[model samples]
Target: MRLKISLKGAVQGVGFRPFVFRLATELGLKGWVINDSSGVEIEVEGEEKALQKFLLRLNAEKPPLAHIYSQDVEYLMDVGYATFEIRESRGEGRKEVLVLPDIATCEECLRELFDPKDRRYLYPFINCTNCGPRFTIIEKLPYDRPHTTMKTFEMCPICKEEYKNPANRRFHAQPNACPVCGPWVSLYTSEGILKADRDKALKLVAKALKDGLIVAVKGIGGFHLMCDATNEEAVRLLRERKRRSEKPFAVMFRDLEQVSVYAEPTELERALLLSPERPIVLVRKRRDLASSVAPGLKRIGAFLPYSPLHHIILRSVDFPVVATSGNLSDEPIVKDNAEAIQKLSSFAHMILLHNRDIKRRCDDSVVKVIGGVPVPIRRSRGYAPMPAKLPFKLSRKVLALGGMLKNTFAIGFEDTVIISQHIGDVENLETLRSFEEMVFDLMELYEFEPELVVCDLHPRYETTRWGEVFAQSRGIPLIKLQHHYTHILSCMAERGLKERVLGVAWDGTGYGEDGTLWGGEFMVCDYRGYDRVFYIKPFRLIGGERAVKEPRRVALSLLFEMYGKSASDLNNETVRSFTQDELKNLYIAWSKGINSPYSSSVGRLFDAVASLIGIRQKLSYEGQGAMILEDLYDPLVKDHYAFALEDKHIDWRPMFYELLEDREKEKVPSRFINTLAKMCLEVVLRIGVEKVCLSGGVMQNDPLVSKIREFLEKENFKVYTHQKVPPNDGGLSLGQAVYASL
Candidate 1:
């Protein structure tokens, strides 16, 4: 029997070709395997029994790194081929190959990295087919070395032999290189004066870290500005330079044990840290090694070294490093050496440069364990380019531009949607340029010419406007997605939920259909459309967008709604956040609705509660107040506050009154979360949707989400939360794409 098989998935950059070659030889099959835009195609002739075994073990005993998402086999007449061979990849086709995400340094590579006798020992660029850079280094489709950033580096003799050997692990590894031929690292002064190169560069970086000097070190995806995590002065200096004041910096530990000593990680968190993805995992802070690292927060973002370069650096350092993106606050991470020297030198005393060019700018991915369930917060780095295999195939090629904050645009064709890596907020020109570059990069990679473009309904959003121009210029249909609805749909799309679901979309701000900010939303929705069935009672953002920075304004607005003029008279922490004059002017503004946009956002409610309770009255970063409150959650406090759910409206006035009467501010976090859970139960029961989807930025709140999931699941409601994608605006692109397809 002869079989012509077509396989599609994360099979290209991975050791799939080599695995197939070896498999065919072992089966005594006469065949050839070749790569294509859609993935691998193979033709094999063998005995019927051997052919059956080949099919079984093809996936069963396939390469550990390879994933076969879809495989199609056709019986063929024997061509009398004498030998099995690996042929050159084919590029002419509808490109559907799943671009593999960058993998962290595997245990085997790490072992070889430190081994003194190994040829690649102490080599910073050590990698095999099982691990190292992928999506970050690739330039185009077929995922061949010639089509990657590694194309310039001619392979050394030993590496060429290893790369061509089907039996070797480095076989067909796109980024495969030895120290003699691969990219080399260099240490430079802020003025671009070269101080050292290669191993010496890493050693100098380690020394700089130990000596409390910040060093901008290049890594797999992009540069990471690192400092000793235990050094308060170093961390403080980094914070000052990066202008990232309150947002917690992700700490890179030497190993799992060191991470355990700093942050309390559950078993699953430990697994995530050790996983090939190597995402920064948010876990409880067991010991505040550097008090300034995560001020006031009980949890910290922690991760292990993902690359051999990072491993070598960590081995040399006495203390774990504070690793944050190599960019100023809110800007895209610096990628190229010139960009690092130009922009990053302002933040670092020394720059650890590398010759390898990053084809895409990807920030570190983030995940947090909520009630023992790992929820991806930011999907980037080792988690991007590898798309979500859609439950339903699209009729036409589509583009979905995500919302403003934590922006990520996506492209969809067939049954797959490849959401771009975290593009950061697209408000600024640099980040917007990054977004634009990535959009075209994906389009060019897939030969995609979208039949439709999808964006949020917010008219003022940069991405929405960009999408509008793109659609108009290309003469394609444009579809605007609702912000919160897509948050729900993102989760639904990821979960393959096409049925009507009670979507609980709670975020800080999203443009409502009525032209107001809608954050706290409950919609009965599916892929096609949504009905705003129930929502939190509208409240004024007294200073408009300014309310987002100052939670006190939101609290003030809520108080004024309940107590009228007497809200100013109530002498408390929240009221005292403003002087009598400021209070009076803000109240007047609230009363007149001057520059005060109304919002039904649960995110604002969290901020209001955070301000009212004095946990945090102002924020330096998005979700700072709520994140602080998450730490204050007392599981011992089983009690909850009071609220009114009446006629498609959630009235928090009752809860505020109860909250004000209660003096135990510590109980506020858990109680408020419980109340929200009960509120969700009330609405879901009323709306009568058995399947519930939790989404939006507020869904990132561990305490609140855990409570909601717990309460809903106990009622036998099939509650769904984001697993493959984030619930925040970062994951909204997936939903927009899903909506476009439906």
Candidate 2:
């Protein structure tokens, strides 16, 4: 009997080919197994019973990361092959090959770490085919050891044997290494390079934690700010040092069992915890952990230690650790040692250094529970560079600038669209540099020189600037797509929707095609074209740039729109923040239409509502006002705050007046947010869009997301949201990448 099999999903990086080679040889089967662009293909010749047994074992047992989505087996009558041979890979276009992110250390490596008899015991870098770095270390395609960062470090005699042995787990493992030949960890205290041993280094880190000192530790992908999770004082001290207020910190647990005390884990969550992709999972808090760990938050973000280094650190520490990006607020993760020393010095007293060179910086991914499933908040680190299959293929290679905030870059070659790890806001120079470096690195790795580039139409966006520069330098044709159109395209790509869609692009703000700020918009769109079907009534941005940071300015904009005169003319000093002259200039700008672009942005509306209800006057972060505003209402129970919907437009003036009425009465609750969410969702449903695609940075608001999704379901309309990618700009590259393909 001769059998032909096709295997799919995450077979690349993992030792699937070699595993098959050994398995076929062991079973005395005759045939060949080769890797194609689509997936691994195998043909085996053997006795009928033996072949059946091999198929059963293959399905029952597979490499950790290799997910066999489907296995199609066909019996062949012809047997032209001799003994089973491991054939070379077939690299072709239009084939679906799984691209996996760099994985954490696996259990086999962990066992060797603690084994005193093993040469790799206590080694910081111990990896085999089962686990270790993949995407981060690869310098070129075909994913062989010679084409990776590991090429610089030659394998020892023992390692060489393991690499060549078909039966060994380390066979063809691109990043296979031990402490003897791999990266090493060092302790840097105030004196620098402390003479302490590895164990003492761990102890010193623990002592620093006990003393309420922050430590910056470098991980496989990037640096992390760490402190004792059980100590409220330590957590609070670190929070103050990092300037993070109220945003929840991700806690790294030693194991799944340790997490149960704080939050319950479902079977899917348990499997995700144990899976190679050790992403941070958000779960409801049990009220035992200190509130300071997640200030003003009901739920907690938790993750199990994915690497051996994390496990070793957890062993020395007493509680769940607060591990966050090692950067000042809104900046990219610090990758270089010198940058970590300079930027993190203010907050960190000591640094656990690593000799491994991190060519790129990837922030820890954040995930949250929504509709009884994990939705990625920030997509990076554990899951990136993996190509999401597109329904249509591109005509030429292209590069895309995602968005400004939570920025990420994307590269597309043939059928594969590779999105870079989370790049921070492009507003900062450091983040911009990281984005450029990663883009260069990925292009070189894939041997792709983009023939085209794409960016948002926004002229002020740093992403647009970078894209313009790169396109000019490389002489690549550039495509400037509408921001909201790209947002709709993203939803379309995710759902594999190739035809026209009722595109609902509601966000904080986007540069409209007609030289205006557009956010809340409904479009009838397809891959080639789209038209703005409906939009919210436009209003002035009172202080322009100042309005984004100060929600009070937006409140004044709404007030002036409702009242005949500017809010500043009312003699309220609070309103006097904008002088009568300043108010006159603003009104002139609105009247003459100099810089004021009419926007129906739902995000700015949320900000205005938040400030009107006194939820937040000054926003410390981008979505702070909207998040706090959403927190004020519960959609579970009935609430009566209603907004008049006229045709396809939402009349926000009534809601503004209602807020003024409530302010005069001095009453507010979470129901206000719930009412607005219900009203907005109701209007969307009334427009008769069968599928409501929720997007934008504002969609990061969980409370509003919950209310809207529930209400849309009740209205018998299908609601779609970003799950494989983030709802924020961190996921913008994916949309941009797909759009470039189109």
Candidate 3:
């Protein structure tokens, strides 16, 4: 008997063909396996029992990196005369093969890097079929070396032999190379002066970091601005140079044990840190290193080295290192070596660069353990270009332009929605160019031409304007989706929920259907549409966009709502932070509605409380005030303030009054957060929806999200939160794509 099988979904660049060939040979089958534009294709001729065993093990014992979405098998007449073999990949087909995200250095490669006896010992670019740069190096489809950065580097005779041997780990590995022929590292001064080459370059770079000098190190995804994490002056200098005042920099530890010494990681967080994806895990800070590294935050983002070069650098240095994305604030990460030299030279003392080029710029992914599960905060690097399977198929390809902050776009065709890696904020020209470039690259790679474009309804959003222009240029329909509605749909799409769900969408700001800004909302919705059933009482954002940067403005607005102009004279800490003229101007703005936009955002509410409690008066970044508020939360306090619902609108003024009264007695931010959770429960209970979906940027608050989930589950309401995609705007594109398909 002969069998032909087609396997799809994340089966490319993951050693799938090698696994198939190995399985066929073990079963004593005679045929071949090949990779085409669609996916992996295999044909085997063998005994009935052997074929059965082969099929069972193919699914059961396949490569750890391979993710088979669907499989089809057909019987054929025996025509094979030769033994099983791995064939050359074919490129002609409708390209549907999922591109594997960049995988971290596997254990096998790490062993070889440390072992002096190994031929590839101390090789900074050591990689095999199971691990190495994939999505970042590939330029186009079929994932061949000719279409990658590795095309310039010719493999040595030893590597060529390994590439030919199916039993070898480097079999058909596109980036396979040895120290003799592969790319090498070089160290240069900030002014482009060469200092050292190869292994000596790495050693010098490590020494520079130890001496409190910042270095720009090239990795699989992009360049990372690195400095010793323990060096307070170095961290402070990096922060000053990057202009990232309070945002926590992700630290790279040598291994799990080293990470454990600084941050308290649970089993799930430890696994995420060590996973092939190698995302930065947010964990409780166990020890204090540099006060400037994280500032007011109680949790630190930490991860182990993902590449051989990173491992080598960490090994050379005893302490953890601050490995931040190599870019200025709100700009795209630096990918090109020359680009890094041009942009980072002013800040970094040295440049540790490699010859391998990065085709796509991917930032480090961020995950936090929420509700005992690792939830993605920013999905990039080792988890991009991999499609998120849709519950329903689409007849036409669709494009989704994500939100303004933490932007990520999506392209959907048939049953798959491929989300772009993190595109950063689309507010500036550099990030906007990155957004357009990645959109074109993904479409070109997937051969997708969208029939429709979907984007947030905010008319002023740069992304929305781009979508409008794109749709108009292509003569396609543009679908304007409400921002919070998409947040709900994004969570629902990931969970495969088609029915109407009670959605609690809480974020900083989004354009509402009525033209006001919305962030806190309770809606009954599905993919097709949503009904805004309830929301928090609308509040004015004094000074409009300025209110976002200065939470004192938001606090003043909340106070005005409660006590009118007299509110500014409350003699609170927030009031003291502002000058008399500023306070008077804020009051006039609230009273006269000058540059004041009305918003019902739960995120703004948190910011207001943060300001009221004197935790943070201004934000250096979006959600900074809220993050500080969460850090100040008193875990022992379980009490909540009072709130009232009027005509389905939640009035938090009562809660604010109670908070003000309690402020004199105790400064507990947790009580305010708990009251918000209680208020959500109150709304859900009133709405009488059994299925609830919680989403939005505010959902990134682990303690608040956990509290809401716990309260809802106790009421027997089936609560669903984002797990596969982020609950923030980073996952908004998936929701837009899924909603457009429906």
Q: What is the TM-score of each candidate against the true structure?
A: 0.99, 0.87, 0.99
Tally clashes: model 3.
0
Compute the lDDT of residue 79 as modeled in candidate 2: 67
Residue-level lDDT tens digits of model 3 in 165-205: 88898888899987999999999999998999998998899
Instruction: Write candidate 2's Cα lDDT for 183-275 as tens digits.
Output: 667778634556454657767777887777788998878789998778788888888888887677888887877888887777777776666
Report lDDT per candidate.
0.89, 0.74, 0.89
For residues 420-477, could you state the per-residue lDDT of candidate 1 as single tens digits? 9988898999888889998999898888899999999999999998998999999999
Determine which window of 10 residues in candidate 1 has minimal summed lDDT.
Answer: 368-377
Clashes of 2: 3
Per-residue lDDT of 622 in model 1:
86
Cα shift from native, residue 558, model 3 (Å): 1.1
Separately for all candidates shown, the number of backbone clashes (residues 3 or more apart, or on different chains) is 2, 3, 0
Better of 1 and 2 by lDDT: 1
TM-score of candidate 3 versus the correct structure, residues matched by position: 0.99
Q: Which residue pairs does candidate 3 place in steric collision?
A: none
